[model samples]
Target: MPPGDAYDAVIVGGGHNGLVAAAYLARAGRSVLVLERRDQVGGAAVSSRPFPGVDVRLSRYSYLVSLLPPVIVRDLGLRLTLAKRAVSSYTPVVRAGRPTGLLVHRAEPERTRASFARLTGSDREYAAWRRFYGMTGRLARRVFPTLTEPLPTRAALRAEVADGAAWEALVERPLGEAIEAAFADDLVRGVVLTDALIGTFTHAHDPALRQNRCFLYHVIGGGTGDWDVPVGGMGALTDALALAARQAGAYLATGRTATAIATDGSSAEVTYRDAVGEHTAGARQVLVNASPDRLAELLGEPVPRPAAEGAQLKVNMVLRRLPRLRDPAADPREAFAGTFHVAEGYRELDLAHRQAAAGRCPKAPPSEIYCHSLTDPTILGSEAAGQGLHTLTLFGLHTPARLFAADHDAVKAELLSATLARLDAHLAEPIADCLAVDAEGRPCVEAKSPVDLERELWLPGGSIFHGDLVFPWAEEEPGESGPERWGVATGHPNVLLCGAGAVRGGGVSGVAGHNAAMAALGR
Candidate 1:
């Protein structure tokens, strides 16, 4: 390549990580070009009007983002408007007079625990809830960085060595066991454990699944780990990142899909096709924002060994009015801005998992519903415009795509109907009645199973974590390579692995992008 024409780096996929990597690299004085397959730059972190006047936040696969480090937010001066409203959750338990449900919100821990103690009458269990989340917050801060770097620095290494035992105890234990050790109430256990297994297919009894819970604990809300949305919607954060990336001197193209990555030892050649025609660029370094499996598909054959197995993700929604519970006395506030878990109890949740494993969507699926409109009213425009419709994101993981028939209409209706049925079980009326609208965001919701998310996101084996978050994978060395062992550095002269699909596993955190840029530019 001609010296004048060579770029220091070319980032593929204009997702947040790609934009972030471009910004960091350019800031470090590297000539950077960002190539996006889609016309829009946000990838999954985008908002588009699928229907007129219906602005849907197409958080495609991800809806929450507290895992994103504050450092990137500050360094890029990314101003984010988080939903100030607190998270509310309710689990219904019917009594003679009326149905009662446990409600938790922005309250003093003492008060929250007192409520729990009243319900379960276990002081020890209440204390455990407080301490567990407190520890989870601390642990997220400590472990989040591990997935970013190719290897830890001397300072980091020394710290890890010092805290080795504590780390093991925290990450290695089964999330269910960990919860059991901490809380006695089955209801409390069900709530806490449900989150641990949120985006994962793992049951509560599954080992290392608790680590997922630990990760989730940090992803939603901080402080005591409450879940919140951006003031306008989650898309606000992505918009800020894109604005920052453009300000830092990076080009963005939407709707242009990347076709192949040709690496010739020293540099990478990125080939993409858009409406115009095929275009290719040569860069000193290359970063991918796609899932590992998607990357492999784009590259075609001779696939790179995957870092993660990939995650199965599903979203169901269309809302006319907000879902009303069967119990009229239930707190309306708790029904909004918070997550609703239909798992009910451990046994039911476990059964749902079994059904999912059997290549069928569970009858009463274990769901985590997040009503975005209630929390961020700005998304719906002005109240004078009309009653803002609510959008609920239901995540189902571990189920393979085969559950749905290849027919698009059949599969969509099936999943949609099934999801509503589960909600109706608890609510007196069908949740679907509230629907002023509904839509499926899964790229191929009808034909493809949730497991197809692995291929769709282009990560290996559909492992969302890119691989297990176990020791070696979490603390990968610079030149290492193996199953569950991270080798974020491609060992090529300029290519750097920059997505959670690389080696750090998955999350909304931007460390993968930051570290990749640092490595490419020798920062």
Candidate 2:
């Protein structure tokens, strides 16, 4: 506690990965310190009471989390309750000359196929549709492990390639091409294609693009579906992580912003400026939670260059009401559980990315929406006496928030309006009345929701993922510099990267931080 006192390690961010790294290191008998810029932690996986008596997620950015390893949660003793289904998506189908709309729950493949057959009956190939999913799940389970850590060595890579023949087959084939080759039914193709587009930066039928397949890797990890909510809120995950770190004797400080990292060839020190004064902490090792590029700014031209440009943008809305489906049964508290997807087919999805890429919002922007209140009643259950409230998070692709040319208030209002307008187009009633409050309720909303916030918040390129997963970049060779390779470890001796930008991409996966600790500990 003395001035300039040294610890074994200093973790830069309080996001889950940073906290997890602290817990692992502290438990290993190493002295660790965690510094967070915000008063509270959790990063994107945080929850808050923004509106009066209504608990809403600040970003609620990520809905389902299957890719999170059980070992980390179990080791941390995190009490995570999987929602009924990971996620459920709905696409409205208009019957020709019927003047009626059918909302299809696209999460359940068989049920979706049946529903699709109702419209494209003669063309649905149920068998091939089943085969595609089965094969995809198998392939994802195989390839997913490779992404968790630095790229495997040559021998490891060869073994993985041998073990991943199924994934290779799926990856080699374009999703639409695979569907056409595998199934005779157009409806089956549409459903599979739609699933491929959710949360991805790619078009639905874009051949050779595997972002959806990468997305599937996360979805399958969910165990049952595409999304899951903690018993209380996403913040619970952060709470659990902090609890783990605290239990292990790590020191945590909020409102401590890291300004620069100085390495004297053998050790690293974090320099910070705070309300009281500027200070420095000496440590044998340092772990940074900001993205690789941002870390470069702090450290000045380290290994990894500007990290992978982030591909997607997210918006979180605390809705007054759950989204109304064109039909009521869309609420499959049972059939298909957690998350919801908005866009429908390959062509429609293609147009979305086209607009986003062109710096314009898509006319019918595709969103993956999650209404946590429906699954985890705890959020609403506690405030029964207060106001009826629900929170919905929509993840979409856009030109960065800073690019909006509007001020924060105007941009926030426009985003809220745009999201609500899209929801109204898909549902029955206008959601304006359901609004108990908006993003303005949470101060971090601007920080977490906008890409510009990333740079301002100290994450390079607003990337939550440390880097892109493009090949060769992901290939790990000794002395390589990319995040997919070196990760949180600074080729610079004792320095380490811990946050989402460190490596293994983002999304609450602690691999980069965890591995960096292990490497620093030389375990």
Candidate 3:
């Protein structure tokens, strides 16, 4: 806790990735310290009781886990539990003026097959769906393991994948070609495309291929492409990492704002401010667990590149009961268990993107909804659980930060209302009816626009992935530096990026931090 102290390594932020780096470095017998600007660690990967006096702790920012490698969890002895949802997703649609839905079961193939047959009137689309994911599944198993190790070159990864057809379809060409060729149904195609557009604002055929990178990251998680719920909300995962780091003798300080970092390639000095005043800490290396833009500022240099403007709306709500679905055959519990697609038909998605890109909120905003409480009710306290309370999270896509620049508050309110209306269209009962009041007797609902995220969480453009994601592999032959091969390299040898902006970094995964620590130890 002493000012002007020196350590072997100093981390600039105490997010999950920073905590991971601290745990690994300290356990390796390196003197380590983590400085966090926030009072509590975890950054956006945190849980909160947003409602006044509420006992429920919603994973307020990052909701699910998919990209975290099993190796890091084992290496750190993380006390975390990730629960898989039985139903993968349910997309409700209106056909011939009759309401229906398509359900994808996580484990039961027959049920899923039957559901697909019922919706499409044939087994063709279902078979195509399997074959499509089959390609991704093969690639996922081949690629995910290399995340924490030295970054493989593009040629090395492609040669290892060995499936030219898959590599060409998923990696070489735009994702739209695969989506169009694999599925006939519009809604089904849209469901498949959702994975590619979660936090990134791009169409399937984006020439830059940002969507492909997003799709690659989404499907390569855990090698099964399954997005699992963090038991007790996201806070549980970060808390475990914090505990592991502390147990390994890493010093973590909150409310420590790192103002500057100066490194001469072998050693570094970090200047930061706390309540009292500015202080300096010297270290052999500095691992920055913040956006590249933020890191560039601290180093008195121009940003490497702009972090993409995060383009989506995050809404959190507490409901007394699950809202009834319009479809008679679909169970509300099952429908809400996994991702519930809304206003997300293939055409709808494209249309929404066009609307947003043209500088307007979509009249029918595309969004996805899921009830976290259905999979893990432990996030709710005894009173709320006994009272049948549930938490619903809605992620509104194609709602870019640009829309809020004119009038932030007004635009956010309008988008929230439009998004809710879009949800109500698929429900037999209005979502408002199922709302629960917090201790203050106000509706237990809150919404965050891209601007809000930028203000509150410091997300560049409110982009959840921090910026447009780069490929997991190195673009060219890596430099001689150890961190370059690990995808955490910076211009300075003694400084590395260990946050979402790092190559192969994003989501709730600790891969960046682990890679940075490995890079530091090796360097």
Candidate 4:
């Protein structure tokens, strides 16, 4: 905590990735110092009771854990539990003026197939779905383990996958073409494409293949692509990481905003500002856990223009009770347990994308809802649990940061209303009627747009992945393959990216953090 004190490594952010790096380095007996601007660590991965007087702790920003490597947990000895959700997803669609839905059961294949058959009127689409995902399952098993290790070349990874058709569909060609070729039903196609568009602003057929990269990260998590709910909320993982880092003799300084970082490739100095004044500390190496643009700013370099824009609306609500579904046969408990798709049909998603691209909110914005309390009631505590209160976190897609540029608050309010209205269509009762009131008698629902996230979390353009995702492996450069490649290295040898902006980074995964630690250790 003293000014001018030196350490083995000084991490410039206290996000989950920074904590991961700190834990690993400190456990290796290297002195580590983690500088955090916020009052605490964990960045977006933290639990909070946003609603006043609500005892329930919600995963405020990042909800689920998918890409966190098991080795990081086991090696750090983190005391965390990620409970799998029973239901995979329940997508409701009106068929022949009757309320119907397609439910993908997590453990029951027969039930999932039956739901698909009922929706599509045959087993053809389900079989195709199985074939497409089965390919990714193989890819996940092959490529996921390499994340924590040194980076591999594109050729090396492609050869590892060993499936030309699967590689071409996911890596070479546009993802939309593959989705069209595989699925017949528009609704079913949309469900598959949702994974490609989470927190990404792009069409399925994007020439840049941004969505393809997003899709790869989504399905390759934990080698199974299953997004599990953190048992005590998202904070549990970060809290354990912080504890491990501290136990290993890392110096964690909160409320310290990193102002500038000056590195001479081998040695570095991190200048940070606290309430008292500015202070500088020397380090053998400096790891940045903020956005890439933010790192550029601290190094007195020009920030990148056309920053990646986050394209999702986050809404958190405490409901007094679960709303009745339009479908009488479907249980509200089951439908709300997994991802509940709202206005996310394949064609509808494309339409929304086009509309948003033209500077207008889609008439029916695509969104998905997750009822976390249904799976983990411990977050509700004894009182909220007894009152039967539940939590619903809605993530609305295709409403980019541009829409809120002119009229930030107005657009946010308008989009929130439209999104909730779309969800209301599938419910027998209005969600408004089920909302829990805060202490001041106000509705407990709160919504955040891209602008809000940028302001609060310092996410450049509100892009959740910190920026556009990159392929996990190193692209084939003319003879550049070595152990020094962790995808976290910067222009300066001592500077490395440990945040979501790293090559193998995105989501709540600690892959980038682990890779940075390994690279720092020269392993």
Cα lDDT, all candidates: 0.60, 0.59, 0.92, 0.91
> Relative to the unseen true structure, what is the C-alpha lDDT of residue 515 in candidate 1, on a scale of 0 to 100?
66
Please provide the root mean square deviation of candidate 1 (C-alpha atoms, Å).
Answer: 4.6
**Candidate 2 CA-lDDT value:** 0.59
Per-residue accuracy of model 3 over 280-304 as CA lDDT, tens digit each = 9999999999888888889999876
Q: Model 3, residue 172: what's the lDDT?
A: 90
- TM-score of each candidate? 0.84, 0.83, 0.99, 0.98
Show model 3 residue runs off by greater than 4 Å. Answer: 2-4, 305-307
The model with the greatest lDDT is 3
Runs in model 1 deviating more than 4 A are 1-5, 53-60, 94-98, 122-124, 144-150, 153-168, 207-226, 297-301, 304-313, 316-318, 383-385, 405-412, 437-487
Task: Put down candidate 1 lDDT per residue, 139-227, tens digits, no spaces.
Answer: 55555555444555434643754554334445555666666777776667777766656545567776545345434434333323555
TM-score of 2: 0.83
Model 2: residue 28 alpha-carbon error in angstroms: 0.5
TM-score between model 1 and native: 0.84
Residue 388 lDDT in candidate 1? 49
Residue 36's lDDT in candidate 1: 76
* Candidates in order: C-alpha RMSD to true structure: 4.6, 4.4, 1.1, 1.3
Off by over 4 Å in 2: 1-4, 53-60, 97-113, 122-125, 144-158, 161-165, 169-200, 204-213, 220-226, 302-313, 328-337, 385-388, 398-416, 437-449, 455-457, 470-487
